[model samples]
Target chain A: DAGITQSPRYKITETGRQVTLMCHQTWSHSYMFWYRQDLGHGLRLIYYSAAADITDKGEVPDGYVVSRSKTENFPLTLESATRSQTSVYFCASFNRESYNSPLHFGNGTRLTVT
Target chain B: QKEVEQDPGPLSVPEGAIVSLNCTYSNSAFQYFMWYRQYSRKGPELLMYTYSSGNKEDGRFTAQVDKSSKYISLFIRDSQPSDSATYLCAMRDSFANAGGTSYGKLTFGQGTILTVHP
Candidate 1:
């Protein structure tokens, strides 16, 4: 029961609507990341947080906002959803204490914007 | 060119056959390499990892990295039906002090899907 979890495993939103995907982990990992997976692109990082209140943009962060008020939670918000935003989103965490620590990922949330 | 490139393959193989998966990267700074296995509708799990250019074997799985050619490979011996899943290759630079923080960010390749039939 101490794994990562994402709410509303599936989501559908109309174009221009605002949507927020929630991610929570019980491991208290210091590094949390958000990535979007599409057909041709494997997994592109949208945003990542090194710790609570410390966030950075990733490869593709446009139109997306992320916040980490607490160490166990990192949520991603789409200000104005577009059809291009329709893809599977994954939340991952890694312990920074070890150099070789592997990233642990949540089940993922499938979002569709029409 | 992308930082990492992999063939998005829906490769099929009979059980007990050997399977090979590979990826190429354009970044020469990447020193840590890894492979992850992802099942349908599930998140990827780390399968193997190697630091620098070398080969590491674990049971039926083997991971090889060639920094000279900027290529990496994963070999599966005696593949089974359970091996039917997507394999992802990921790499990251060893420099962790760019901004005084641990730069553990990873660049991932497009996963390769493999199906081993019984």
Candidate 2:
């Protein structure tokens, strides 16, 4: 019951439309991360939050926005979706202070922009 | 060059054979190396981790890291059909996310697909 969950396990949006993917965790982990997985690019970090109300951009943050108003939720928004934005998005959480803490991930939300 | 690189192989092997997956990185600052196994359409799950340059064994999985050469490897003994998946190599500077100068970010490889056939 204490696990990460991503909503809309799959999504489809038209280009120029706004889409928001939801991520929630019952574990109350301090660090939350959002990453997009592409065909040839593996997983690239889009954004991460250290705690409530604290968020930072990741390796490829363009066109994406995230906010952590509460420790349980970290949502990623695409201001304007594009065809290139079609990919699987994963949400992960961890207690980073502990070096051995492995990131716990959600099932993921697959988004496709046409 | 990418911080981490891995051979994206659909490496086919007979069941019970030993399977080796590897990754190379250019960053000498990476102090923690991890291997993740991801089944198709599933998010990667951490398989094993090594804090320093050494080997750690867990059941059928073994992880080895060599800091001097910036190479890391994961070996699966007695590979099985259930072991088939994309193995991703991830590294992090454990100190980055602390209050000091790092952010504890993770750099992951492209992933290698492995299949154990009967």
Please report the candidate that would top TM-score against the real structure.
1
Those runs of model 1 whose alpha carbons end farther than 4 Å from true positions after fitting are B97-102
**Candidate 2 residue-wise lDDT, A1-114, digit = tens:** 789999989999999999999999998888899999986899999999888998888899999999889999999999999999999999999976677888888889999999
Q: TM-scores for all candidates?
A: 0.97, 0.96
Per-residue lDDT of candidate 1, residues A1-114 (tens digit)? 999999879999999999999999999999999999887899999999999999999999999999999999999999999999999999999997888999999999999999
Q: What clash count goes with each model?
A: 0, 5
Can you give the lDDT of residue A1 in candidate 2? Answer: 79
What lDDT tens digits, residue by residue, belong to model 2 across residues B1-118?
8899999987999999999999999988789899998988788899998997999999999999999999999999999999999999999875744453235568999999899999
Candidate 1: RMSD to truth: 1.1
Please, what are the lDDT tens digits per residue for candidate 1 over residues B11-73? 999999999999999988889999999999999999999999999999999999999999999
What is the Cα-based lDDT of residue A83 in candidate 2? 95
- Candidate 1: give the clashing pairs: none
